[model samples]
Target: MSRGSTLAEKIIGRAAGHAVQPGDLAVVAVGMAMSVDSIAPSVIKVMREEFRIPKVADPEKVALFVDHVAPACNVSTAEGQAEVRRFAAEQGIRHLYDVGTGVCHQLMIDRGLARAGEVVLGSDSHSTAYGAIGAFGTGMGATDIALAFATGKTWLRVPETMKVELTGQLPAGVMSKDAILHLIGRLGIDGATYRAVEFYGAEDLTAASRITLCSMTTELGAKAGMIAFPQERLAEFGLPEWLFADPDAGYVHAETIDLAALSPQVSSPDDVDNVSSVDAVVGIHIDQVFLGTCTNGRLEDIHAAARILKGRRVAPHVRMIIIPASDDILKQSVADGSLISLLEAGATVSTPGCGPCIGRHQGVLAAGEACFSTANRNFRGRMGSPEADIYLGSPLTAAATALEGKIADPRNYL
Candidate 1:
């Protein structure tokens, strides 16, 4: 009799055209490999200068995004973007999303570039976001990405599985961001190091929420994050039966999160894992409140903020910025009037892209300043001056902060 295999095992096995288990090395065809502007120059260089490869295995499978430091933050960035444009045109790559198009991972899902049970690669660590749709997505270095671009293939050591079971409905005023923050806090920074985390009981989570949950797996130091699709969702995601983890599949570790009991959580500055409940850090003065990023930049997140900010003006001392994750989301928000609500509430809007998530432009923090941001990662100096502080939370939490000019609980406003 055959042994039961995990979600990661089965996906990797199918891609490898053979059975695979934890610790196995498998070189599989990449469905898509994404490179952002900041690293595309080096990726292209390695492919051309080092390997001297001619003609990528499939130009159609390669994607490039000029999102980070977009709109020419500086002359050097402008030149780098130009190089990417020339290369894409020359190589017949049609998946280039230039400035204002939003994040690479968001664009990937927005355009249906990521599919269930497939492998997706990105140059950014948050590439794990692709796992939102049940795809085997992971980040690779410039050299590995260049090699994948040249041959349309890359290898990964199959990671052991960590089953994270999420049960119970999330109570009112709580968001998926809180659940993920709670998980990260309990698991610690390196809790799931080099492991694949599969959410076993995620049926209650909205599709957008699932994206938020999966993308933050990187903070747990996970290699890949996957969600086991329920029968109804299986059809929606086009996932196969095998894509679901077997009942008897082995797991390196397991934990459960009860959403109903979870409250709004926050990741304090200088560490993504430095998390606590909203009440614990309430009333901390905030200079800026930013709402956008692959983590919380979708329409649902925007609606959450609008619900809180509608008819309420931002505090006079606070600056609020909302950037949609994609052009489509931007249009939807505008059509639905949520964008107007945010703007009327004294929030400024930037072009739909990464914005200040990376801290290069848009909403950089000043020394001694503090911001409440929806983006992932709040490492020291992550957004600007190391002296500046960043507080990570849900859009609802961010809206509450903007409304009060401090780190207030979203539950209070909701």
Candidate 2:
């Protein structure tokens, strides 16, 4: 009799061309290996100096993105991007998305490079974002990516599976960001260490919402985040799914969350696990509101925020910064008047790139000031100024706070 297999086992097993069980060390060929400007230089160096590799196994399968410091803030960064561009051109790589293109995770899916049932890995921790579309997505280091670039395969220890079942529709004004933060709060930071988090209940998740959920599973210390995307959705991309976890598949841990019982939530300064209901922290003053990042910068998020901001202006006391996740999203926002509404609402809209999420070029907070942002990770100095505090919230919360100049509940605005 065939043993019941989890989603992680099925995907890894497929890529390895054999059936695999949990805890098996399998060397599988990757469907796609991704790298960004900050990490690509190291991959290039290792491929050239460490491995002496003559050619990439399949250049088309390896995608390089120039997002994290796009447009090059400093001479060092400019040189790094130049090196990446030169290397890509020399190696006949064709899928390099340059600056102003989009964040790596968003571009991976928007460009049709990532799809359901494929095993994809990137050099950024948020690579798990692709799991929204039902891909097995995880993060790898530069050396690992370089090896994959050279050989087109990487070894992974099959991880135990944890089932996170979603039940009931999300309550009004509650976004996936709140649900993920709530989960992280319950699980603490290391809750899912070395485990694959299989998210069930696709019927309740939009493509964007699923992306938000999977992106933050990394914060729970998950090895990889996965969802069994619906076949009709994958059919749009012509992707096929071979296996899904059986109804009886064994999971090391299982938890079901009722979204209807959840409320809009927030993660306080310096810790993602420091979570509370919006009512608990309402009216706390904020100095800035950042409305975009790889986590929640999609068109859906933008539209949600724009709906809240329409016919209103941001508070004069607060600085509101908006950045679209990608050039395509940016163009869509502009075409649909979302960008115009945001700008007219007194928000400062920047080019399509990671702006203040990593605190590089724009909207750095000042000492003793606080920012409400939709981006993941509220660690000290994550958005510059270790003395500055960051509160993590959804786009709706971000927009409401921008209007009120404080931590405000999005439900009131909705």
Candidate 3:
């Protein structure tokens, strides 16, 4: 007489006032719906055609952001943003954010738009980033987003749950990003397909660490990602404490990853799951070092890199770029002197946006050049030209590589 476990199940169970079991088809009410400029216009189009409505069911519950193409790169992007702005105004939406606000995922959490235990749907893949703060947030396509806007509800088949318990303390210089890369390496790309990954055990769940871990679940092909919150952690965000899971709660699958022996791990070019330790790739030539993204762009991540690059100048032939996740984080870095250290060490500090991570607007590489990035995804041409090579690693490794003008281990400097 036990209920099945899944992320969609848990959200539907709480939203529908009934305990939902896996494999069940359910219509779940949502607490919030969000979209960025990249996909908001398409969702708006779908809403106009499908619902024939100029407004959403609840405008206040919807959020639109211009973070994806902030500062408006070209005429096309600018027009897209203008359309989103016009739609928000026409629909009377109140939570719309313009440029300079920050990235959508960080802005959503920082602005208190996501509440604990509520179902939130976003149009961006990184929507799972909100799960770090205890909200059940996930991504969908434009059509699904439009339906959610029209009805404040969406249909989902409850997926199974996978329990990932982390035991043992993370060694110094090893971060949550490294931990996740380690998991991807072990599980392969299809490891958690159509399942929810729940992180439990040991380390206190900090906002930064949770974001780092959950943001990369896409690499494992997870449908949704989550972590349990301790009471103190909830209070930090001024939210009510909620129960995560009972001691007797069951999971479809359970696995534990021991991090005591883990070193800095890197997902090599062309494959996210193709992981190797820092020692394996040591001395590889690197042309660039990038430190920013929703995953590793927090103040703590920046400080970790700064600690390693404090007085050392970047290699003359290497290009190092630092982009904070938000304007607030950028300001904090300036106040804490991390910005100065980065600049003094010959690293370029870019605006608070996802630059060079997506290879869209900034830091595209030349043929055969190599880069070590803190962003997620290491697929071919992810950061720039298809011919350019990219490597994914923690901020610490990226910074050390910038110093040596190649892939060097941080322990070398320590």
The per-candidate count of clashes, in order, stands at 0, 0, 0
**Per-residue lDDT of 73-117 in model 1, one digit per residue for the tens?**
889999999999999999999999999898888999879887778
Tens digit of lDDT per residue, candidate 3, span 1-414? 774344445565887678877677778888889998888989999999877866699998899988776777789989999999998888899898887667788878888887767888899877877767777778899999999998899888777778888888878878888889999999998899877788875336457888888888878888778875544556765554543554555688887888778899988889899998989999899998999888798898889899999998999998898888888999999999998999999999777777777777668787899989998887888777899889999998888899999898887776
lDDT for 312 (candidate 2):
99
Evaluated against the true structure, the overall lDDT of model 3 is 0.82
Cα deviation of 328, candidate 1, in Å = 0.5
Report the C-alpha lDDT of model 2 over 1-414, residue by residue, as the tens digit.
566888888888889999888888999989899999999999988987898997899998999999898888999999999998998899999999998998899989889887678789899998888877768888999999999999999999999999988888898898888888898888987899889998877545777888899999899889888876544555564556454677777799988888889998899988888989889999999999998888999998899899899989999998988888999999999999998999899988777777888887778777898999999989999888899999999998888989999999888987
Query: TM-scores across all candidates?
Result: 0.98, 0.96, 0.95
lDDT of 2 at 2: 64
The CA lDDT of each predicted structure is 0.90, 0.87, 0.82
Worst 10 residues of 2 by lDDT: 229-238
lDDT of 3 at 303: 94
| Model 2 lDDT, residue 298, Cα | 93
The clash tally of candidate 1 reads 0
Model 3 segments more than 4 A misplaced:
3-8, 202-205, 230-242
Which residue pairs in candidate 1 collide?
Answer: none
Off by over 4 Å in 2: 230-241
